[model samples]
Target: MVDVVACGELLIDFTPVQQKEKPGSIAFEQNPGGAPANVLAALSRFGKRTSFIGAVGNDVFGRFLQQTLIRLNIGTKGLVLTEEAHTTLAFVHLDETGDRSFHFYRNPGADIMLREQDVNEALIAQAAIFHFGTLSLTHEPARSATWRAVEYAKQHQRLLSFDPNIRASLWEDLEEAKALALKGMAKADIVKLSEEELAFLVGSEDVVEATAWMLGQYDLQAVFVTLGEKGCFYRTRNNFGTVGGFQVTAIDTTGAGDAFVGALLYQLLEVGESMLDIPQATLEDMVRFANAAGALTTTRSGAIPAMPTLSEVKSFMEAAR
Candidate 1:
């Protein structure tokens, strides 16, 4: 049985390499990406059995993503290929300050073509955790399909995990998008968000107040707030703490959150850790391990390529201590 089954988008991220002398000109590097796929790959690399459920185009990019996931040891049995639409493409440009910007070339891309019937309820039922992102909920059939998966997971009494990964450009309106995102959060047992994400979602500048407000409103089992480099802060039903991340020279932070989230879920499932009433020590241990995984990912490049193996994470953790 798969420890986690992730459902959502799978696309290509084209990163730019600028010329040293000619600042205006740059070369592009193709990388396999998509938040859900990154998480699944990370979990698989961490020695967890992971399966992915999503749609991909019949194009070269789709085939490349499929081969990439297989190389990471993620099961691709649930992947659906659609011939009507092309695979989604994200053109990423990083400025001199290391700030990233995106240009999406998706109009009815394969990722958004996911249908309700495409979701395999039985596969989700067999998994320990079900993870998804809000991007799939922005369109028609995929939106309904994502909700269907959530309903099925809830029916099976499995853990529902979510990461909003909100992109303002995709939504019809900010208010409507926030409402829909909150609906997904309500169903999620564990909600992971970056500091900026929390502020934007809650409309607050104070991270602590925003997180505390979300915890109070949603009645969630656990809330995890990731602070890049500083580490992760978590609060459970009755426990709370901050786990420091391993010291590392970060190169590309593209997949850091996915690595951390996957490792966190893997540790929770491996140890049978409960979200209902988790102990403070257990939370710390899990976050520390996750932080190590995230830190290790930043030392490399790309989303799927940078995910560390279980042995690598262990060695890095040992060296940190």
Candidate 2:
């Protein structure tokens, strides 16, 4: 059985190589990316049986994306290649702090053209976890596809993993984005959010209270709030703690959060179905390992291309201590 199955966008990210210092000119390199795709790529590096359910175009760029995922051993049986629209492309701009801003070129890209009928229930039901983000909810057909898959996962009792991975520029309406994000949260058993996303949901910057409110408002088993350079905070029904971040001079922050989430899920899979029963100490150790994975990712560039392997993450963790 597949350990995890994710349904969302699979697109290319053109990341700039030169920063503010090189003001004369800027250069970009095409990288395989997408929030859900990045997570699956990170898991695949750790030898997890992961599958992705999404769409790309039938064009050359889409072919490159398909081959990249296949090379990483991510199942693409649920991937739809359509001629209805060209593949989506995102241009990434990284600031001096390594934080990123995005500009997307998707006037109804092939990813958003994913129809409800394109989602395969049999393929999704084989996985223990169903992962998704609100990016798929910005447009139709894909929105319907996402909802159908969520319902199928619920019926099959798969662990629902939600990451808002919110990029507000993609949403036409801020209120609608909030409402749709909350809708996804309601269906999630496990949530991983960036600090900004947490504040968006709770309307407060206080993470402790926001996490507490989320755990109470929804029947969530666990909540993880990623704090970038500060590492991350995780809370379960019975336990909560802050795991300090690894020290690294980050060059690019893209896919770092996805790497962290993927590492956490990798540890969860190793523990089998009894996830909530994991010891608090063991949970903290897992968070540290994940933080290492994320920090290592930032030292490099791109999304899927920069994801560190299990051995690399372990070595980073060991050397950090």
Query: Model 1, 43-134: lDDT tens per residue?
Result: 98878888888898988999998998888778788788899799998887655434456788888789998899999877898899999988
Off by over 4 Å in 1: 18-24, 96-99
lDDT (10s digit) by residue, model 2, range 205-236: 88889999998999888999999879899999
TM-scores of all predicted structures: 0.94, 0.97
Superposing every Cα of model 2 onto the true structure, what RMSD results?
1.6
Global local distance difference test of model 2: 0.92
Worst 10 residues of 2 by lDDT: 267-276
Model 1 error, position 84 (Å): 1.9
